[model samples]
Target: MQLKSSEETASKAELIWAITGILVVFFAAMLSMNIVITALPVIVSELGGTQIQYAWVLTGLLLANASSTLVWGKLADMYSKKVLFQAANIIFFTSSLAAGLAPNMEFLIGARVVQGIGMGGLISLAMAIMGSIVSPRERGKYAGYIGAVLAASTAAGPLIGGVTVDTLGWRWCFWVGIPLCLAALVVVHTKLKVPRYGTPGKIDVFGVILLVTGCSALLIWLSFAGTPEFFEWISLPSALLIGGALAVIAVFVIVERRIANPIVRLGMLRDRTTILAAISSAAIAPALFSCLLFLAQYFQIGRGFTPTEAGLMLLPVVGGNMLGALITGRLITRYGKWKIYIVTGAIVMSTAMFGLGFVLGADTPIWLIIGALIVVGLGFGAQMQNLMLVVQNTVPVTRVGQASSLIAFCRILGGAAGTAILGSVMAVAVGTSAVAPTNGTNPVYAEATGTLFLIAACITSVAVFTNIAIKEVPLRTTV
Candidate 1:
């Protein structure tokens, strides 16, 4: 009995460290996502990359991220998650170091892909591990910490990236990312002792192969669809790529269905809550990525702010996300309800987006832009993690990682597509101009961004209805 008690105590201590380590990894990985966002313009200028390359920079990371999330999630159920967690950090840290030293646009894009692969694991496993440790009922409170870390990391990334670019050089963003990545790895290596939940089972290698190839081809095709790098949308290359990608997806679905251990159990999505939560999660990605990547452009290139100034100007968004996450998370934990916040967040987010679209122009006041950002941030703060909460609650304890991955996969998939599509749209609208100019007087850029926001507002509205379908279940009290 004394031995048992000591073991239990040690286990509890390990759990605490595990959570801390993953959160640190989570922050580092997510920080990588946005760190380069504000720095893109500078990177582009230095590399002499085209408008399409600009899109590829963000899309590259996002595409790899979305593509690998499901794979990593499934792997979690097959291997020791602690090991996987550490592996992700090593990959991320290595990639970031490589990216910082990239000699050209191609090197940078390739590095982004490697960086994203690591991030996929970090993002999915962090949540999955959280699900492993805490109950759905208490997840909200804990998720608040995740959300705060998320907000802080994401919020600070751009600012820090901008300052680094302004003061040190764009390469320093990736270098800075390395220290955090290293810190997270050290913490996990020493402290985390996550129990193995995976039973003896074969990893569906074929399913993974199909998922990666199909998703990659699809994202690449989407990235170049209407851009000059690829032929016209109606051209043979476009059709073949689209058709071939679709065929690969069909094959993947079939492979997953027949596999004994599918990466994504398609049947699990039959639950209304899971399906709707997924849809809602997917719907928000385009708007989220578009805003996240381009808002900096709008500030620097459209509103005449310097990179550092633009990064600072984004404070409203940071503050809003921070407040929304904390307040909504606590409320959900207290009341044991989640869908209401999700729905409210959707409505608020869309409205705020529409407000920005309508009021924003070449000459819109900066204060108004900041105000809209705050409201949208609040909505995102409320909406983002609760979707994971709902999906995790709906699934079995063993399947939390799977469901959580699905949510992330859908969101990042949407981001990849959105960034590509909107990037092309902006490229066309702006007409062969360097993406950023000092004065922020590009009327065309302003007009195109406004249209994009309107579209995002429309897309986000779909989530409001999807949330209605999210059936609230009794919250689970333990892992």
Candidate 2:
């Protein structure tokens, strides 16, 4: 996404500072989502929450984030990216304040919902701004840095959350994020500049409602039906949820097709780059997100490691991501091509998935598990941001927000669907929604987990084939 040469080109030093400022906001947004994961137990106990209430604390954030993703993206096209970015920081900081001061579980959960609202905008708008400033040829280097931040923050979240809970108390898990958000706000205000497009006529209220409803309903169904203690997958409630989600989505499509200014640019899917990116995102994202949960489980439930120790064990995967992203970014910039890396990355990821499926297990040594994960991380770091660069490059600047956020939304939706599929298969295989590691035993659990990874591998292999269909468009040198 770029303007004509008539538009002023940003200076090299300016772009560097701009990217640096955005990275802090990006890191804060990513960290906020995961920082509460390991602190939940303490928060629940102190607040005397029920099991369902405890689950809601996390689910609230997820639902809000999913529902708000597209809306925020659309807003970016309508308003200044800098303003939206700063506003998102305010919202996140405010929610953190509320959550830290929350006297009960319900208040804390509600605050998280607000936090998610902020996060949705922060993530989407930051990328949209990045697209506006950098050309496709150079975006990979920045994207790689962004990917590294994302990977590191994700890996560090539990470790930070656990330490916060143990030393400063559960509330500080929320309070600790304030300084980071504040710094992002200051940097963005001082450094970032983005021109707004034509003022959008009357906001697309109807479309926003439809999209939020559809996404929320879909996420709700995934959260509950996928849990064995909740509604069974085939139960009446689950059927209604699935049906409602589809109906809402159908209505949303109709609205988008007819609206003057739609929240989602439905036409983008017609583009080959977008279609390929969407497919790859849908196919491969589950392997990343599901493993976050599974790896934690494998370490804690299977190996009986403490939370901090488990998080530490996952560091190699994060390290591999940083290494892979930096190398890929430099090579892409030097060669002025991305498809080669996309294809290679897909093959690498598929291989890693297959190895995790067939070669690694509970009895498998820790070194072997880490080794397989490092390969997966490398493959993921290479493909994730590079694919987005493809889609963003193809779309015009005005539609960049929609294009980038659509890819993000696709990954989220894919992860939810993949998790459901994995959970259902495991439930049917082992008669449990959750796997329990017992005395280093339970070959059935290992086999079920392996089977899930195998399914992921088969799905991801589709990307290698999909990449072949993409024609190489020359990378843009100017934004």
Candidate 3:
């Protein structure tokens, strides 16, 4: 009995260290991704970039993150996850250094793309690693910790950026996460000890190339369309780009089906719960990403708030996110019911988004806007991690990495698309040649934000039905 008790204690200690190591990496990665939000306008102006290029800074990262997620997921299943996680931290650290020193807009965008690749690994691998150790039934309790880290990093990013940009300059925003990343690397190396699950297999190189190519083409077209220098929405360039993207994606589907070791197993997606969860993830992602990204711009440019002030104003949303994640995570663990929270979250998110649209003018009451943001955050917090939890429940432990990453890929892809589309919409609303409204308050830009949130509301509402349709299975009690 003493021996058994000792083994249990050791196991618990190992789990604690493992989770701590990964959460550090997770926090750094998310912080790096968001730190630029408040500083983007200043960064673009200093670099002599256009409104289109401004949006590309974000979309570029999301695209790389989305595209590389599957590769990392597949690799996690085959390789030593501890080593892979460390490697991702190195990549993120290096790219962040490069981004901080970038001499031009193009260089910064390139560095961000590389940074996104590292972020892709961190995000997917963190979840994959968690799935490897914790059973689905127990994951809900731990997921609260993960969600709290996510919320903290996300909330801290804008505030950090705001402070860094105001005091040190915009470049420091990129540099701030390096220390965190290095610390995470040290912890992960010492603490994370997980067995490699899958045997070495052929990676689908062609599928990756096709997926990246197709998605990049689509995003580029979306970002540039309806701009003065680019082709109109109905023009030949649009047709060719859209058609070519579709053709490449179709080919990718075929390749995945034929490959012995596919990056994404199509068969896994056939399960009804997986499909519904994926749809819900994809649908809700845009609303979450768009709102958070654009709100920085709204506060800084629309309301004439300083970066520091704008960051402080976002606290309500962050509070909501933290509360929602913590509360739902505990409840799910206790009761083993998930669908209700996600569906209700979707409905709440949609309502908040619409409310934001209605009250988003430059002169709208601050209290009213804050209330809506809190609700939006609450809705997002409930759905984000739970979607992956449901999907992970359906798969065996060996395939958890792939299943978790697939859902992440969908969410990031949707975010990239939404950022590109909504950026274009705002650009069009502001006039094709208009630069980013960095100079001062622009009513045109402020009005366009309202339109952006309305579109986000429409897109997010789809998740309500999808989550409702998701059939929840009993959470597995064993890892």
lDDT of 2 by residue, 182-228 (tens): 88778778877676653665567888788778877776676567555
In candidate 1, stretches whose alpha carbon ends up further than 4 angstroms from where it belongs are: 1-14, 433-441
Best prediction by TM-score: 3
**Best candidate (score: lDDT):** 3
Q: What does the lDDT read for residue 113 in candidate 2?
A: 87
Residue lDDT tens for model 3, 81-175: 88888898899899999999999999999999999999999999999988887878889988888888888888998889989889999999999
TM-score of 3: 0.97
Could you tell me which residue pairs clash in candidate 2? Answer: none
Rank list by lDDT: 3, 1, 2
Clashes of each: 1, 0, 0
Which should have the higher TM-score, number 1 or number 2? 1
Q: List ranges where model 3 is wrong by over 4 Å.
A: 1-10, 432-434, 437-439
Question: Which candidate do you rate higher for lDDT, 1 or 2?
Answer: 1
State residue 138's C-alpha deviation in candidate 1, in Å: 1.2
| lDDT value, residue 45 of candidate 1 | 75
TM per model?
Answer: 0.95, 0.88, 0.97
User: Looking at candidate 2, what is the lDDT of residue 107?
Assistant: 84
